[model samples]
Target: MLGNAEILQAMEQLQDKLFQIAVRVLRKDRTRIQVSYEDHLRIFRLLQEGHKETAAQAMEAHLEFGKRILIH
Candidate 1:
């Protein structure tokens, strides 16, 4: 089993990746595609609830929304 430190490190790495993606999306259009705190909380809650598929779909939707903002 992974130790606590190792798990924390992995989570931090995942957070970094998500942050990078958000930054890329914001670079496209900050005014339109800004992710709200509520959105982040909802995604986190879904994951915490063990709804992995739903969480993945929510994340995908969020990213696609960002892409749409860029296209317009």
Candidate 2:
């Protein structure tokens, strides 16, 4: 079992990794056009508001679609 700080740290590390992946997968001329921090927070808040399945799937699909567009 991890302490609270350890758990938070792990989550932050995972978040950083995801952000990097998104950046690399969606960067346009070194500009990050992928999901931003604000967008992530909005998604979190929406999930907290009980938007479990649809919003998440939609956001992921939207992100992947953008990645396809920007990466190509």
Candidate 3:
């Protein structure tokens, strides 16, 4: 319901590795999970409202935040 087939395929390709990392990291820090979940919810709502640009920005912020947290 959210993305096209190509987007879904791309996300699917990364799902396994992402899930592994998420499990390892989130197990150690519950707050990170809550933050990421909130990020997703924000993006989902923006997309549902047809605010593609804002949703993209929200997704960008989410990824950037995740990258910072995941990186050493």
TM-score for each of the candidates: 0.54, 0.46, 0.69
lDDT of 3 by residue, 2-34 (tens): 859988888887998888877766765678888
By lDDT rank, best first, the candidates go 3, 1, 2
RMSD of each: 4.8, 4.6, 5.1
Estimate, for each residue in 1-72, the C-alpha lDDT of model 2 and write its tens digit: 367898899899999987787667655544434345556677788888998886688688757765676567
Candidate 2 residue spans exceeding 4 A from truth: 1-19, 25-35
Task: List ranges where model 3 is wrong by over 4 Å.
Answer: 1-13
State how far residue 7 of model 3 sits from its true place (Å).
Answer: 13
Query: Which sections of candidate 1 miss by over 4 Å?
Result: 1-35
lDDT digits (tens) for residues 1-72 of candidate 1:
367898889899999987887777677766644354566688999999999999898888876887676566
The numbered model that scores best in TM-score is: 3
Clashes of 3: 0
- Which scores better on TM-score, 1 or 3? 3
How many pairs collide in each candidate, listed in order? 0, 0, 0
